[model samples]
Target: MGWIGETVDSIKSLQIRQVLTQTVSLGMIVTSALIIWKALMCITGSESPVVVVLSGSMEPGFKRGDILFLHMSTDPIRAGEIVVFNVDGREIPIVHRVIKVHERQDTGEVDVLTKGDNNYGDDRLLYAQGQLWLQRHHIMGRAVGFLPYVGWVTIIMTEKPIIKYILIGALGLLVVTSKE
Candidate 1:
């Protein structure tokens, strides 16, 4: 009877130890991911260091479902360069090429005109009402690097909410059931 009681107590202790260990390991993984993202933001000097191409606007050069790496530099924005920018009252960002650059004589500030590679005309129609050009503040960053077709995963998950839910559930189950 004493031997049986000792065996049960040891089993319970080992189970508790395993649970605590897994919990701590999971916490560390989440924290590490966040640290890496924040570090990228700082290194790139952009709020979002990574962006997914959603449309074929810049097709032939940048296709839909491609992943773009962005960087914000102190150097002036120039024409013929691809840039991502946000328009007033708009939530989604636009990716296009700078077609023209207008420099001010009084304030020395610059305004940029952008157009998609495949589009018929400039982006002035897409801009906010009464806005003709994109200011520096509206620009997020310029494309520095890219990975082809890598952004499809994010696009699918965004377009299909059910798949995202299932994937999240599976990952949660995997973590809970992992023995190692």
Candidate 2:
């Protein structure tokens, strides 16, 4: 009876140690991801250094489900350059081509007009009410590089949240069950 009780206590301690190890491992992984994201933000000088294209507005150049790498630089913006911007009332950001740029001589600020490649008209209608042009502050970053069709995973997860939850659960299960 005494030996059996000793065995039970040893087993409980081993289980607790395994759970703690898994929890620490999960924390380390999350911390590493955050560090990498902060490093990218510092390197690119953009709040969002990577964005997934969610629309087909810029078809033939940037299709849906594409992954775009953004870079915010000090160079002057020019016509025909692709940019991602946010509107005053809208939550999602838009990606479009710069059709026109009007630099004000008095303030040195520029009024930027943008249009989607597949759209018939400029983006004035899409802008906030009473606003005709996008300012420098509205611009998030310019498209520097892209990966074709790489953003489909993100799109699928966003469109179907169930899959996202299932994926997270599976990862947690694996981490907890992993022997090594």
Candidate 3:
């Protein structure tokens, strides 16, 4: 009991000023990241301003590990626009190009069909089971630009469990041990 208290007291009393300085520095770094993410959301007009391609569904045009920039506009979604969408029960989002659009006059709503560039058929299988078409609500954003092979780091980390852990551990260690 005496040794534990003495040890803790030594640590807590020593380097108190330096510890607070590093702690505040780390907080600023984390806050800066959040601010940058929010700024991207505002500037791109998309909830997810950037996305990493996880599958090769959109090959030739976009391969796995490619990074895409998205922008949402009030204009109606048009055929040929590559968009990211979410379906009920799916954990990950899907990126595909719009193939068809059915506009309803009564409600002014749009029903869309999407297809992958490398796929043999439209994205019927990717949609919610038994659901025929994707409504505007499923769409997250439209692809405005892309950077090829940039997201391989994310893909590799996802594919290899240990790499993900190591990367995360390294980041945590860096944050914890960094002086500034």
Candidate 4:
């Protein structure tokens, strides 16, 4: 009986140690990810260095599952450049090509008009009611490059809430079950 009790105690102690190690490791991983994200933010000069295409609005040039890399700088935006911008009352950012750029004569502020390659018309219909153009304030970043079909996972997770939960759960389980 004494030996059995000692064995059980040892098992409990080992389990506690395992759990603590996993928790600490997960915390470290999360911290490392945050640090890397901050580094990317600083290096790219963009709030979001990377973005997943949420819609097929920019199709033919960019697909819905494409992963786009963005670079933001002080350089003047040029025509034919792909960019991401937010419209008033819209939560999601849009990816489009700059078709026209009009600089304010008084303030020198640049206003841009965008269009989708696959769409029939410009994005004015998608903009907020009565808003004619997108300002610099609404611009997120200019698209530098893209990886095809890399953002499908993100799109899938967004499309189905359960998939996100399941993926997170699996990652957690992997972290916990992994032997250090």
Candidate 2: worst 10 consecutive residues by lDDT? 8-17
Q: What's the C-alpha lDDT at position 139 in model 2?
A: 95
Q: lDDT tens digits, residues 36-55, model 1?
A: 99999999999999999998
Per-candidate TM-scores read 0.90, 0.89, 0.84, 0.87
User: Candidate 1 clashing pairs?
Assistant: none
Q: Whole-model lDDT for model 4 versus the true structure?
A: 0.90
Rank order (by TM-score, best first): 1, 2, 4, 3
* Tens-digit lDDT track of model 2 for 39-113: 999999999999999888899888999999999997777899999999999999999999999998898798999
lDDT scores for all predictions? 0.92, 0.92, 0.90, 0.90
- TM-score-superior candidate, 2 or 3: 2
TM-score of 3: 0.84
Cα RMSD, each candidate: 5.0, 4.3, 3.5, 3.8
Model 4 misplaced stretches (Cα beyond 4 Å): 1-16
Per-residue C-alpha lDDT of model 4 across residues 1-180, encoded as one tens digit per residue: 999999778657677778898899999999999999999999999999999987788877788899999999998887899999989898989999999999878988998999998889999999999999889999999999889999999889888999999889999989876788
Candidate 3's displacement at residue 139, Å, is: 0.4
How well does model 3 score by local distance difference test?
Answer: 0.90
For candidate 3, list the clashing residue pairs, or say none.
none
